[model samples]
Target: MSGPRKGKPVQPGQTVVVIGGGISGLATAALLAAEGHKVTIVEKQDVLGGRAYTFSEDGFRFDAGPSWYLMPEVIDHYFRLLGTSAEEQLDLVKLDPGYRLISEGASEPVDVPAGRQRVVQLFERLEPGAGARLEKYLDSAAETYTMAKRRFLYPTFQSFAPLLTADVLTRLPRLARLLLEPLHSYARRYVKNPSLQQVLEYPAVFLGASPFTAPSMYHLMSHLDLDVGVYYPMGGFARLVEALEKQARDAGGTIRTNVEVLEIETAPVTSRRRPAAVRGVRVRNGGGSVESLPADVVVSAADLHHSETALLPRNLQTYPERYWQRRTAGPSALLLYLGVRGVLPQLEHHTLLFTADWEENFKAIFGKDTFIPSPASMYVCRPSATDPDVAPEGHENVFVLVPIPPDPGLGGSGDERLERAADAVIGQLSEWAGIPDLAERIVVRRLYGPADFERDYHSWKGTSLGPAHTLKQSAFFRAGNVSRKVEGLYYAGASTIPGIGIPMCLISAELVVKRLRGDTSTGPLPVPLRAAGVAEGTVPKGTTA
Candidate 1:
């Protein structure tokens, strides 16, 4: 479906300073550079990819974040708009058992195979009529996913026009229920079996939400992993970040590392004007020199809480400290990076271990009186099962994540409590998942907790995935892409419009472009600019881009 255009089109050579070197920052730089913007990305860290940063220790290379490659179409489309393709950039591999699921004291683990029919058969075996239930559930999910992509996800909801679209108007009743009901309740309406039901529940955890609280609109999440298929970029997800970095540079954008943005500088548009216009960023370089990086536009791809509260003044802030008082932050994690001595046959490339009491575990993470869950459910990724480059020869690369309350009070990396939590997780996996020698086999280990996230990413409440995808924080309510209190200030990434995950970050970058281009099309713009007024300079004339 086509959308109407409004707002002013971008001029030829406006200067843009993109704050952060994360995926969204790199992507936005690449896009605006193609439009002839004098684009520069300033990263506080010495390396790029923000959370997706990679490190090599003891010959075991680790992708510090984003292990799953769930949405290939979003990735492919994003690269396509940049005049490249994911297939052209990265070597992708599809896994047969998309992921493995294990439960405490279960006789056998469940393998969610790649084929749809096979998954349905497994569902039926687990619960009578569940295969048909899964089909019905996914059918609804697929429709919702498609509608969201076409209408809700793509458009920069700077205006209310997107809300009145035919697709949305027709489904107002269905969407209202989705907004009101929680995911766990929605899933139970279809299947009663605990094992089969868990298939839906686990995604909510990774999404930084509790199944009992997160909106049912998120039920579409299962359709992505269970039905759409899971993939990996043969080396690691960091390789994808490297590809984006190269693409940004190739598009004539400059990336400056080891530079911290001290403030988002602003000035009044006129002496009488109410909202200030973004002038540039105040920065402190690695050499300890402070200077102003002047720009006509500034896009903060950093954490929204950090950008609004720390960078901008309180008067110019869109979301003040008082605002977040009512908002719910997503879960923070206790991250364990382990390099084991030998391969572990019990785990898959992607595996999920659920405690017998996952609901209680979620309460520990998201409830008002938050605490760490013991005998906790966790996610383990043994990428060495497929990607050999991540680990050393005769060794396995293990990454364990246990979701915890997003409280910075829990402390930083190497903190005693955090380490004890990691230790408990290791022991639980050894007993529950049948990896008896898990602890002793460890040759390398590192623990990262909430405080580490706060120190490195300036995350609000040290949350790893940004704000929770609750009803109050979804769609237009998530935080607008463009600022209302400041002119020429825009936001992208997991913090703003369209919400979380790698694919959403990609869309967020595109939404920033849409806002700038005044191209308010809800559907994704076609590549090569077939129309007279398409994206500038990214694609060449003719020859089927």
Candidate 2:
């Protein structure tokens, strides 16, 4: 696909520095540069894609984070803004039997197919009258999903006016149904079977909260899976990173890797009425020397807590360390990336091995004492099952992820703990998936945990998916995208509004662009403006001067 056509340049647009080269940072940079701004992305890692980075060794390739691709429309919307489409740039293949679920002590694994009717049939097989109930449940879920996309996902929360829209008021009843109950309780009201209940409630776990604790609004995730469908790019998530990087570069956004942002430098406002504004970032260069890169505006798509506590001055931080200590974090993970020499015919492209004691498993993760439970629930992804390019001719690339608590103590001294957890995961997979001597077949193996998240991504409390989607930590209650204490400094990532996942990051980027442009409309760019192309002093309708 060709790059976006360059528009009439501004004589001197703002020099915007985006800290972090993750998806959100790249998307923000691309849009800003396309609008005639000078954009640069600074990433600490050797590679550009933060959590979505790909690594290859001995002909085996693996995506380090975010394996699932559930929301395609969000991604398509991003590409559309650049006058392109995801289909034109990436090879996307929708999974057939989307995933396989292995319940503890169950005789057979349940395969969840792509379409709604097929999934309903699977539900019926599990319980006598569940198919009809599932149909009802999904119909409600579809309505909830629609409300979310229209009323919640797209809009910026800078003011309360957006919440008073006619569309949102009309959907208040459905929104109440979603917000007033917990997901686990809501699902139980529809389905009586234990396994079917697990299937309906499982999506909440993806957001790093137990179904019992996560708000029922997240039932919308079921629609994303059963209705919208699950997909994987042919080359894994790494292809997405490559596409975003290309889009950013094509739009004249420069990315500098191995540059660690040590602090955000600021200048006092010249006027007493104005707040402090960003001057630049102080970065540690590859040679371990400090250098400053000046900017008119700064967008931090890095970890929210890291940005507030470590990067900004105490006086400029909006959220204090005590504020973070009181907040709830999403689950951290024990990740195992294994290069196996032989193929496992029994496993599907994606499989979830759930423990027998579901409540106990959650207790182990979110309870005060955080540790890996016996027979822990785990997710395994074999990308090579669908794409042969990720592994050698006779081999498979296996990714094992087990959710654990985000405990700071886990990071300070976690070697012995992680080793024990890895052994438990391997043994569980061996007995459950019929992969005997699983450890012996490993041609290569790398283990990552809370400490790795802290070291590599600077994740707060080593949480992988950002703050938990609890009642207090979601929507308007979540961290604001624009900083109130500092002028020309903004945030866009999992920690900000519209919350977690790849789709949310894309939306977050758009939100930041809207805030920067002073736009209030929660919709895609107008077709006429996109076609006519951007020009100086020609801010689109809904954007302020």
Candidate 3:
């Protein structure tokens, strides 16, 4: 299953099986199929978009996962890779007041508006000298973002040689400090006010980490949020998933729903030195009978732990159980989906409610002695504040996410433990956000917890994303995208290289395509032969370190 010679225009049309129909899987299928491969995506659920799945009931449509759409250039680059553009597929709305911060003990909530200057001004108004410092911080972050997109993000880290290049060697001292220092400490270097510090540190949670543990290199995230701006694709994340599905189908990719992969069938090893080769995937069809789909190559976009530990034979499991045991998983969430009666004017399209005891709250989620916190920091998305089509005429679509310890035993929907956790958050939100009638106004309620994530996504430790981006688990230290133990077997999605989030997952798909092309360069893959414009800062091949 070795790829053709380098720089050769190889023949295509090899049958490729993509496990999991998530963003990475669908996007991988689109690229591969468009390249003349016969690509087929098999999804376990009745629909696609693994975590980005949507559901509707009683006139309310809800995006069950991934509400915030940050990193537009990544999406734009992906759209162009499909020979299309974001402007053509769906309407994207740039959020105003970027997001509302409801902080503990504060009389007024801080509304972070669109644009970098406004944020600087807002910080200036909050604390003297913080505005200028923040500007300096974002400037540094923007430079780091450029460096990462150019030399880090898209490449498959097959060796540490790429990290040893002269350019990287010259910046080793600075890069090491960024990678070793905690994000909280790094943010404090720029901002003095606690609230302003929180704004820069909060993105660690989305990376499945606490500011105390996450690498300061992730300050690059601030550029995406405060500089690139937060956006909401008008119809929700599922709509973006649908658009990717359309792209895959338009490129001749076959999509099959209600298909559970039973086993990743691999050819028996000819030598201990030569790993087992991919044969195909044995899957169970919707009617509960088994079927075999042969493939020259297989990409597992399912949870990496699930794919390696459960699907492959022990010999072929590159990341075994012991490997996962050493990893720190991102926090599992206690999610509340409520269709409340009437609108909540106080809530913005995106609301972040932080507990005053910020460090303690994170300790509750990620500490050695973990437990769900009463005054847990939480995020609320009231889609109705922006998109009217999500809910009935007057009702609001409210989704609450509370980061909790990733304990599968903490229980599931309708359980006492889960309900108690929800109660704690609801009570806190009512007081902190001044939404006095928050509880009683709920006309519809749905609860999801760590156990639900385990059951639905086979998430390791029920983590909402993948492993934490702690200093040890970032960059070259993070899990690789390809399987060294199995020829023609690859892993995608949040669990592998490049880490979590929708945009990263899309890039993970591209990385797999790059691997198949025998393109070992450590940089972003060249924009495919299409004339669609490239995203800002995307590095062309041969120009990277």
Predicted candidate 3 versus true structure: per-residue lDDT over 402-479, tens digit per residue: 999999999989889899878878888888888898899888889999998998888899988889888777776788
- Candidate number with the higher lDDT (1 or 3): 1
- Count steric clashes of candidate 3: 0
Candidate 2 weakest ten by summed lDDT: 1-10
* lDDT (C-alpha, whole model) for all candidates: 0.86, 0.83, 0.85
lDDT of 3 at 527: 57
Give each model's clash number: 0, 0, 0
In Å, residue 46's CA in model 3 sits off its true spot by 0.8
Candidate 3 C-alpha error for residue 166, in Å: 4.9
Q: Order of all candidates by lDDT, from best down to worst?
A: 1, 3, 2
Give the per-residue lDDT of model 2 (tens digit) for 1-545: 11112222223378999999998999888877766678999999999788889998889998999999988987987876766678877899999889988889888888899999999998888887989998988988888777677667766666556568788888778677677788989999888877778889888877778887999999888998888788999988988998888878887789999999999888889663336888989999788999999998899999999999998878888877988988889999888988998888778999999877888899898888878777888899999999999999999899999998886557522488787878789888989998897888989888888988988889998988899888888777788787667777889899887788999998898887767766556555542123125564454322222
- Please state the error at residue 270 of candidate 2 in Å: 5.1
TM-score for candidate 3, please give it.
0.94
**Model 3 lDDT at residue 464:** 86
Error of 3 at 231 (Å): 0.7
Collision pairs in model 2 = none
